[model samples]
Target: MQHLLQIFILYLFILKIFGDNVDENFPQYPETKQLYETYDFIIVGGGSAGCALANRLSEIENWNVLLIEAGGEENKRLMDIPGLALQNQHTYFDWCYMSEPFEEAGLSLINQSICVPRGKVLGGTSVLNHMVYHRGAPADYDRWENVFGNPGWSFDNVETYFKKLEDVAIDSPSLPDYFGKNGPLHVECAEYRSKLYPAYMAAAHEAGIKSELLLGPNQIGVECAWKTTKNGYRFSSNRAYLVPIRRRNLHLKLNSQVTKILFKGNVAIGVEFVCANQTYTIYSKKEVILSAGAINSPQLLMLSGIGPKQHLAELKIPLLKDLPVGQNLMDHVAILGLQFEINESPNVVEDKDMQLKEFLYNQTGPLSSYPAETIVFSHLSNGIPQYEDDFVTSTYEQQNHELYHFSSETWAEAFLPNNQSKGAFYIYPVLFKPKSRGSILLRDNNPFSHPRIFLNYLTHPDDISYLVMGIREILRISEQPSLQAFGTTLYKNKLRACKQYEFNSDDYWICQIRHLSTSLFHQSGTCKMGPKDNLDAVVDAELRVHGIEGLRVIDASIMPEILAGHINGPVIMIAEKGADIIKQFWANRKVG
Candidate 1:
């Protein structure tokens, strides 16, 4: 009886901290009672991009916009807490897609396949992501325009859209012109800073890398990462875009899965989806925008008979357009098992009940922040002679290498001790611009079934070598006097898989890199955007399918090349620009 009372009290405490107002008054699921047979625009997903698109497109008022999402409403109690970010993964809110077993990489994981967690809730992956808001380097967008022949996607052209969606709450003196004062998405640094944060920053400085804003003029240093949060809670796209516009002409349908796109000859007209155990067909008067993300967007296109001719024919589905619907898949891959032990204990939490009370009253405690403390972007080719291979030198010259520092207490709670005495953290070296590419293929004709994801990580020798060099750099940082002051030492537990090679040898690290490789969940470029002359181009520069009219893919799937940072910020910017492009296209037609 006492245990039950304790549980009840804990629930009340959580409710007190997060409050029951938003969840209690959240717009009803399937906001519209009667389904409209036709709408001016039909969005296929209510994800990060979809929510922004719904808000922007519905602003016209006359245009009735319908957003169909496969998942239900978000669980505010669990999702709003910044500290419970990873706890949301592999739950009912996640799609839980797994990559195919690799011969080289992910050998140590279950089934030798890595688990890819894409949010299945209303806010999509934004609800499950680490909330770090980072726009890629200016050169990244420049390459998108100059190298890929995208006319309006240069940094200069798209900079306004970046500002259009951001509302900066943190004080950044050097980034005065880069931030937007009034926007829906609130951007701020985490309130709770652990003792290890300063040590990590000092250690980076000791290694000759100074602290600078990651989104400022240059991204070649270290700094505290900014996040998409407001008042110690997550500010998801659903919260930022959909909730505020519930009274508008926007119609949202929850638990609706779009199975196929209806087309007339070469023009997209409507979509067939299932909701509440009944299938319905909805028509789009203007265009059918695909914001179903990299995985689902490609899967939906292929299931609707618009993919590779040979693959479609094999499935007995008639080919509509012979486009590369699911190729050139890119993601940021990071090496695991790189942990450092420190003598200094973690931030002391005296009493769990007191910590809860502090969070409930002041909203400043361990619960107010995610564990990712600082990020470092560096060029590895200049100093390391042994790793200065041709590919590494050229790629480093492009400035795409990124290293992340994370407090491992929250991440490795299952293995670590429960007390706050032991202190340890992780420094992950991420491969941002991978030369190796994978593909996505339909498992069968069923839209409900997950697509066969082939994330060919570390297939390229250059990628593995680059990661190895990054590990060496991390080792150097650990050896610095600033970190050594904390008695920082690399955890030297030898893995069974690499026992044959000498410990700390190059071969042992290479073997460990393959066995423990994992993804950062930034999958993109499945539906490559390029010029019409490019045969492998799935969508044109204007985001329209190459051969099909009145259809556009405006999500990460259309990225010609994945950027050098997290994709959430860029995805929102894409939707913002795409909405403007769409409004212009229709307005011009009316004028004509």
Candidate 2:
């Protein structure tokens, strides 16, 4: 125990030493800078992708890689608390950009976009997310490779990289074989459970469905959630990739915003950034990679004159690559949320003073970062058989021999609405793959102006149809025998009855959804990766912007399509693989 404590203290000390260097107030580089030679690689956006790239690229001692972030270093406090993420939104720590107005959202934004809050801190969204670590259905990656024509990006091919980035935080016996042990990001058990978790699972079972791992034998089942946490702490990319070795060689620049990429003809020579009273330019000798996530990535690209010709012409931004930069914005949009109640449990909102004390005192209890209780995955469509995605639950059976049983065909994952929740319980019915696609545009030339996020949500006729089907399923599960005992209530006076039960108005059910709908926040696909001839293709399989040199995009923006689950896990893996790709590219350059 003493040895373990020593190791833990050592880790914290090292992280603190590294993280201490980041400061918006850190003596700003003089306006008239002492010009250095050049770095071999320059990665923009110190979010998930950027951090991974920097960590991986720096592995080569000879390779001088510079990572430039527009945000501050990782805040250990925020890194360890899950529920506080929402509270940080719109603060100095967040970009706090609102979306362009929308009509479908009931004129919520007056046709103005809604608020978009992305982390401006070290870990990026990972620091701000609910921390449910789900690597979407395997089929999604297979489709991604097909769409982008990349041989190595297939689910099977990318599995190795995923394993390399993930460290399961659960006991060995409780995990599947595919999960790894010594990875960077720690994926642990549900941080805090809700009163409804067990009932939700039991109710699903009562309805003839089994509580099993969605990634198990079949993807049709229901199961609990697996989060991206470590030792009861939030595990963002900054935590895994940045905090350990930040002070070593990384020139992490916070409160520094990139204005434009300086190019000599087609080659990106350096970048211009505004620090305080003055602007500065940093040079990159070999490459400039963008990892500013889905929204900012495209916005930056367009600002640099690398988007569609007509769009740039209208915006008066010079056209560098007329290549659909912000065309295909996709997000995991879910109808608001459905709420349930629990009279007995001590809800997360009940006691904040105590919770804060718990965190600061013993480092145990609700203060731990594991926010969401559990997340269940299932394929609910037209009586479809469960599709075996990436995850599967393996178990041991009787007889000196252990028989493996899969638990994914029918499952339900529930989170007890702890302090992290807003008093009531919310079940967000996520539509993994929606036909609807949105667009991200430059609201104006001002880098601080919020981008126009025209999320013509439900624009695809089928998207709402699937949602209606999911609402119906949500209602069905609520009425299951097990849940009936819990006295769980629906939105209102039974709008649409279960198939075997009574019925109501279609409009009524739709109304319930609109009123309850909330953002699952899995936004992506703006700078889409696809085959060269594809009209909306922004980058190729190599993650290289189609028509540009010395520039590549390496964030969720490159996702050609949305996945079957949460995007955090996949994005982390993408960064890990991207690092390898960049490393190999440079290595071969030397070899050749």
Give the best candidate by TM-score.
1
**What's the TM-score of every candidate structure?**
0.90, 0.82
After superposition, the stretches of candidate 1 with alpha carbons farther than 4 Å from their true spots are 1-30, 348-354, 380-421
Q: Under the 3 Å rule for N, CA and C atoms, how many clashes does model 2 have?
A: 35
Query: Mind sharing the TM-score for model 2?
Result: 0.82
Compared with the true structure, what per-residue lDDT tens digits does model 1 show for residues 390-468?
0000000011011111123212321223243656776778887788899999998888899999999888899988888
lDDT of each: 0.78, 0.64
Q: How does residue 74 of candidate 1 score in lDDT?
A: 76
RMSD of 2: 10.5
Quote the lDDT for 298 in model 2.
89
> How far out, in Å, is residue 392 in model 1?
26
How does candidate 1 score on lDDT?
0.78
Which candidate ranks first by lDDT, i.e. highest? 1
